[model samples]
Target: MGEKQQRDRDLTRWGVSRRYSSLDMFYLFPIGEGLHTIEHKGRLFDLLIQNRGSDTTLVVFHGSLPPTQLTLPCLQGEGVSRLADVNLIALADPSLVMGDIDCAWFLGDRRIGPLRPILSPVIRYVLDSLNSKRTILFGGSGGGYAAVNFAQDFPGSIALAMNPRLNFNGTPSSKLPRYLEVCHGAMSRTPMLRVKRDFMTPNLLDDVNKQQDFDLLVVQNKNDKRYLHRQVNPFLSGVENPTRTWVSLFNGGDGHVPLPREEVAKLLKDLSNMESQTSDEYNSLGFESLGDYKQSVLSQDFS
Candidate 1:
């Protein structure tokens, strides 16, 4: 009969095992290290959180998945242990009305109006609950777009993206057009330019240039020619502040895919350690940048 009672009834109807007294209570509940669905503002977010009892939280956003499948990468095999002691949370993007869509860059679905506004608050709530002092956003491809986009909301956070697609509007062959038509209710007759600009920013560089406090680490595979020329190169060149961004170009892996997981792990660990120390301290300790760090790690990996 009451609002809380109605909400409880809905959760029970949806087959949720537990009942929460309130949304705040749900967000505050001690989360064990595993897959969880946090309901916020009438939307459900699937998050796989690996808690390591550390002050740092690494939120990994998944790239485009296969048709009709919703699998989170880095969840299998080595799992979150590759990041070591940092708390890792892997998030799955909500599908559009179509079931085959992989990711929408956390742009929200028909059910939930705009996603980032809702999703950002939900993540902030989670970070607060975890008492996270430092935050890192990681992802590849479309997920990379999400990592950089969301980093704008959390200033001073780290955004580690691998071969990220920065311009959705420019890449007409990408899933953006279809995503707009299905999720945002754009008609076939509607101009794509209007749809893209109306629903979300056409380019991520626009947002990246505006944020001053965050650090961006972009790892790109040189073989991904299309992305290298269109997305990565353009994005990097457009960056107003080179000091806040790091780029690592390598020849590992095939087109568009990220470098080997082991190499990525080494980079993450090295960056995590170095970031914990101030720049002056890091320079004093003889480290210039993550590019140098990547080279060092690569030399060791090959040898």
Candidate 2:
């Protein structure tokens, strides 16, 4: 049999049917100015390649349970429409129902078997081609965890995590049974449960502290029942440079509820426009207090 056919057969053994071939699932097409769809390793990624690009790149990671189809392109479209001009890239997790492994958090780590080999090269290629002076990685929840973990791979990058968990090995949250189901399904397919468990966000942050000069921004809703005190607070205390990190606490919204689109747009605009010679520049950007943040969203005063 041909190598490709043998590989297909092997994937079949793992419950992947031939109809779901990587080539069949992945495609690229332009959706708008500076927006395009890309598929890498049978997963979707969105790119917004703008002419007004700067030395910085904005990498957005989607939250858990993203729709499986046309994810990246949609994100790119929304990003370009709302945020100011800047290069943007977005990646979606493969597991459709669960947030686990959604951020490629297990990439380059001991868990998840050969999945990393399939993903890491693509990520490296994207990052290398950009040659960005700085990269800002941002995501909510599961994506946020990924941004924090992956920021170690890119020196001098900034990671903004919104209500992200530090790890996923513990008991599942009762309120999110669907997410738990997906996590269980994903874990059953990989050796993640048995592999060394030390490569989670907090531990990865330790490595980032030792080897990288990166900034971290964690935004948490004070009313977040799932992760506010449970994960976000622990992560804040564990990081090496607490002085360089910033935490924005908003008062309303459940942990899983998406942040307001306008607030996210404003954040992207601010990040794109700010000069980052030092941490002071990052700190100097005005972030509204929790009340103000909520009021602005209600009043439609993102400008």
Candidate 3:
């Protein structure tokens, strides 16, 4: 397809036209609490916003979908609006729209460039204009990967991830290879090399261990043996700072399923209320038992 044809196709697929990149461009249009198109480095970033004029903003990211599912998740529903003290902004992973992939962790395809780098500045621009004092990024499963991935860019941000895929190295899903083929310029097809590339900084447990600025709260269902063995165990084993990185285990749900929305809202509300406290006092945020769980992971062979 030609450039114009491709742009038109994307426009139809994404459903936005008025692109804004800078503060000047953003103010050119009357951006309110709804879906808006953000143009960053010639690529359109879809953002759904609920402008409550609050100091705190909850940025929600959606997880993977079935191949037949076309519409963006979290966009059509009343997402994260239960917390009235915060403004809302939700992002759709643009990579899902481009061909047979279901989840790319918002890593973006080669043509679209790296999404986190592009989106970091764009989101910061939007948050600056909104005068947001605090940010909380929320997601589950694949979306949880993206929530933690992007939260690193914004210091003092909190990432609430449930049953998150910490690294793409060992994931059996073909989407990672498909993403590498499509997004990373068709690099080496070898699995080992692919694993190396996938787990680079900002996208792996090793990188997350080095992160001290942002608080990470990972909620895992104890019944989900798959995630416990594949993701949660390995992640907890590598955690450097127990205070900053919290692992909360619940005794419900099966493999890869999300926690009840009511529980999620409670955690978010707790984090939002404690945003004003210094980093030292963050351990008192009602997750004091996380270290015990981490110790249990270490004692057993959950890996």
The model with the greatest lDDT is 3
RMSD of 3: 4.8
TM-score of 2: 0.63
Clash counts for all predictions: 0, 0, 1
State the lDDT of candidate 2 residue by residue for 1-303, as single tens digits: 111111011121123211223422422211223433344444433334433345666777655444353222224224542465556655544333123322344332222333334443445555556665667788777667667767766667788777776655422342223332333332443444433342233344556556556677777777785576556554454555444566676776654665676776677667766776355565566443323333444234222
Q: What lDDT score belongs to each candidate, Candidate 1 first?
A: 0.65, 0.50, 0.67
Candidate 3 ranges beyond 4 A from true positions: 1-18, 21-24, 27-31, 40-42, 72-77, 83-85, 171-174, 184-203, 275-286, 301-303
lDDT of 3 by residue, 182-219 (tens): 55546565853654454344346767776667878788
TM-scores of all predicted structures = 0.77, 0.63, 0.81
Reference-based TM-score, model 1: 0.77
Q: Is candidate 1 or candidate 3 better by TM-score?
A: 3
Clash list (residue pairs), candidate 1:
none
Native-to-model Cα distance after best TM-score fit, residue 67 in candidate 1, in Å: 5.3
